[model samples]
Target: MRIIKAAVLVAAGAMLSWTPARADTVPEFRGNDTGGIIAYELAHRVDARQLAVDHCASYGKVAKFLAVDAQYGGYVSFACRWVPYGASNQPLRTLY
Candidate 1:
């Protein structure tokens, strides 16, 4: 039983390593709210993790209504949550 478990674990690790890397973003980034934002940011960082903003802008670059919110590691700071577009505000949407 122990040997079987070890073999299974080894197989799982091997499969994970075999997972192909895409030209786009990481698992955290995608199409909607958290998903889309994570996807775009991951793609941006795929080359070099360094970002221009202290935190991610709201709605990333796609949404013009809400503020921006950046992510570093797992933590998110509020400071620049307001849109840089200035005034003309609306509902916030975080996405690509």
Candidate 2:
């Protein structure tokens, strides 16, 4: 009986740990413009940069992705810099 109880407890603990937490709010990309650069945060690096560029478009500016990072649980932060029309810019590269 003790062995069965211990096994059940372990299984219960495992199930609980495996369950994902319910997020109260939806995760969203956030951004800000600083010195002609759009800084952003999101769950994924690619999406973060896209968001920054989109934001720059809203401000009537063209952007090129600069730096990105995704180190903690899909939480990413990135920056986009303005580029002149017809000028080439480096592709987006995630640091991690």
Candidate 3:
């Protein structure tokens, strides 16, 4: 009887300890046209954006905001453009 009880307790403890892997959403940045990416695990959207923009700027270019949208888990998706050839404020979208 004691062996059975010990086995049951061990099984229950194992079951409780074994947790399924979770796919949690995190903050990420990507260029809309250039395909540059910056990823960060930040809790706030504003902070994530700032970190991404700062990372993108470290590549020696300017980061421009194209668009922003809501992502999963309250994260914001930022569409940006890195001005090339030292030309600042270049429009990514062209007019016909």
Number of the top lDDT candidate: 2
Task: Please tell me which model should have the higher TM-score, number 1 or number 2.
Answer: 2
Ranking by lDDT: 2, 3, 1
The digit string of per-residue lDDT tens for model 1 on 4-92 reads 99999999999988997775543553233332233335535552122213223444432322233444543121222334576575544
lDDT per residue as tens, model 2, 9-96: 9999999999887875545555565313322333333554455556666555555554444444333444445556676753343333
Global Cα RMSD, each model: 10.1, 11.3, 9.4
TM per candidate: 0.27, 0.35, 0.37
Model 3, 33-61: lDDT tens per residue?
34344443332424554554664555544
**For candidate 1, what is the TM-score?**
0.27
**lDDT of candidate model 1 versus the reference:** 0.41
lDDT of each: 0.41, 0.53, 0.50
Backbone collisions counted per model: 16, 0, 0
Backbone steric clashes in candidate 1, count: 16
**Model 1 lDDT-worst window of ten:** 47-56
